[model samples]
Target: MATSWRTIGFEKNKKLFERAIEGGELGHAYLFSGPEMIGKRTLAVEVANKITNISVPDILMITSAGSESGQTIAIEDIRKIKNFVSIRPYGGAYKFIIIDDAHLMPETSQNSLLKILEEPNASSIIILVTACPEALLPTITSRCQEIQFFPHPRTIMESVLAEAKLSKANKEFLADFADGRLGLVKRIIEEDSFGEIEGAVKKIMYLAKADINERLDAAQKLTDEKNKAGLPRLVLYWMLYLRTRLSEPKAQKMLSGLLALNEIVNKPQYNHRLALENFLISL
Candidate 1:
């Protein structure tokens, strides 16, 4: 599904690209780095939208999957990008490739991508999106135009939450409670059973103090409550929870491990139960 510039939360980012379009200064490659689910991916597609005349051309999206599903990005994925952009556009100005969770790429994949970045084709643009930019190689980061996405301020978040159909009081509470993640806020609106992430965080605190057996039980219990498809969003909830408390030394430590855990969860072949157990056991 395509998203409009007005639909996503990043009006400023939309305008930035619009200016770039007018000035004809768009780069061949870009890096959209920020927290998980904060409209980074949406904005990347929207940048494509600005030039596509609402008829989005072949905008290839590369992302992670389980080992059975080709695992994370491989050298072959880069080859696909090479083949995709090499073709001359029939109508559109350029081809676009948006790589979601690009930081999950293995070293081989990253090295393969570097070749594309070094001699980018003018007829195509690549956008690499990730929550953990630090995980990407420095060479990869240095070659692209890095755009940093941040959480929305309270007032802006309130407007984004308006689509949830909540009352004034409920909206205000969620605006602050969500801690500026537009994606988390949108999830609560779209999923009736999603529950409050704050409640999930509270459970995390309790689990942290529990016995190993109890903590392990809690991990399965949580996963069982949601279908496997929800795992990525579930991971984002925990990430956002830890992200809000980065000033705390303990949370800062937990977030580092959470990032590595995040990389594997999207892969269907990975054992999510054991992964969650390990996280809780380490606590």
Candidate 2:
């Protein structure tokens, strides 16, 4: 496979980076934001690989996965970036650092990251890859150049489906659910009925009918081990639902609250479970 963003329908983004790189105009910080299962991280790695093709030991790949399960990146992890940047780059090339799930950095971690952003070393290049750019602080975002990605067009998505071995209905299910997320389409093909996303739709009716106590109980259940990564899907579904119902007087408030709660959930410093409980009660 070709090792470039163009490999994943991100030709424009690849060109943008290429121009900056060839012109020697690359910025100190970059924010790569896009929908989940898209190629944000893939492109970041491609950029790094292109620049540091030969022997290089300074690149750092950080993910919230290193933290305790279900928790965001801690202040301690941010310190690694601080320490990593203090050293000058080897052979005068940039010291590349990519932080996947950038939104998972708690407030304290972000503040710590801000210090590095404010006083960026000319030898360092930081790339923050995230699906939720809004979860990051404005000060942090303002310091970085942004590259946005979107889903592939309908024609492109349909073309991909043409190669699948699925039955007509199964193919349609992947088409509707993946909605141009190529990564998601691959996942659905591999996991089928075990895809957690299928469960997000089943909760809308339960959420609507449940009382405060029932909702609170539901919130507790949602925080269990199984739902670790599915929370984003749930939030996205509610946000979309709330947007369509904005004409309803109460829906506006609900939307605002949900948005605020979503931000809190990104920062592990907050009591995310309580936030979910409060959000359910308000609903």
Candidate 3:
């Protein structure tokens, strides 16, 4: 039988799980921290499945409201689990609550959750998983057994790409741009759209040389396709790339423009297209 804590390509974590099983030192509250898509949630859920004696598919996966909702574990969802936690385990040794992207929880929610962590029910185990653990409350962090997950070895990443049946060129591209993130790699493999963003980046750079009208046109095109939330990130990366390519004075100007653009993009009332157009024109 496949164990719930068995994580793919996580040899070190697997050993840790084995040791926990051997020593009977299973924790009631665990904080699993790692880069996005490095399998922190996967491992957490696997452990939860094991403790609950439930099939992985039967595990209730709840999330927040947004495009990234599937990944955002919300506080309302957490509250729903409180009653469940109060009860005894249904079929297994414990009832497990795996909170993915726990850092996304609001301060109010975290405070609400602190009470549960402070005095957890005997049969309940809370597992908080996040890429940005620093965003979580220190009090919450103090109450949990922390586990760190690192990126898989390059060899392991290469093997995973190979198994996905990607061409050599695409595999190299994914490996270079994935930032040690398996979720990013999986996205590239599934959508085959990674290069589209690069093309958009190139267009933005090209616009810097064109007239204001051309720049505005390019900005509108890029923002329309990528959305307001994503445009600043692309511009930020482009600015970093330009800094390396241009003279010091030119780079400084571009960096300042980027900072200004960032400020505009962050404003709730700013029109994304207009802000992007102004930034592109200034560039």
> Which whole-number lDDT from 0 to 100 does residue 5 have in model 2?
46
In angstroms, give how far residue 19 of model 2 lies from its true place: 0.7
Candidate 2, residues 112-201, lDDT tens digits: the string is 999999998888899999888988999999999998989877677778888988888877766655656776676667766434554554
Q: What's the TM for model 2?
A: 0.78
Over 4 Å off in model 3, which ranges?
A: 1-6, 55-60, 66-74, 203-283
lDDT agreement with native, every candidate:
0.76, 0.77, 0.68
Sort by lDDT, top down from the best: 2, 1, 3
Please give the RMSD to the true structure for each candidate, in Å.
4.8, 4.2, 5.6
Better of 1 and 2 by lDDT: 2
* lDDT tens readout by residue for model 1, 1-283: 2334554556667777877787888888899988777788877877776565544556788876532334467767778888888777755787888998897687888999998999989878889998778778899899888888988888788666776678787687667657777876776777753465666677777877899889877778756635555666666667767877889998887888777777667543468778888888887
For model 3, give the RMSD to the true fold.
Answer: 5.6
TM accuracy, model 1: 0.77
In model 2, which regions exceed 4 Å deviation? 1-6, 54-56, 86-92, 190-195, 210-212, 224-230, 234-264, 269-271, 278-283
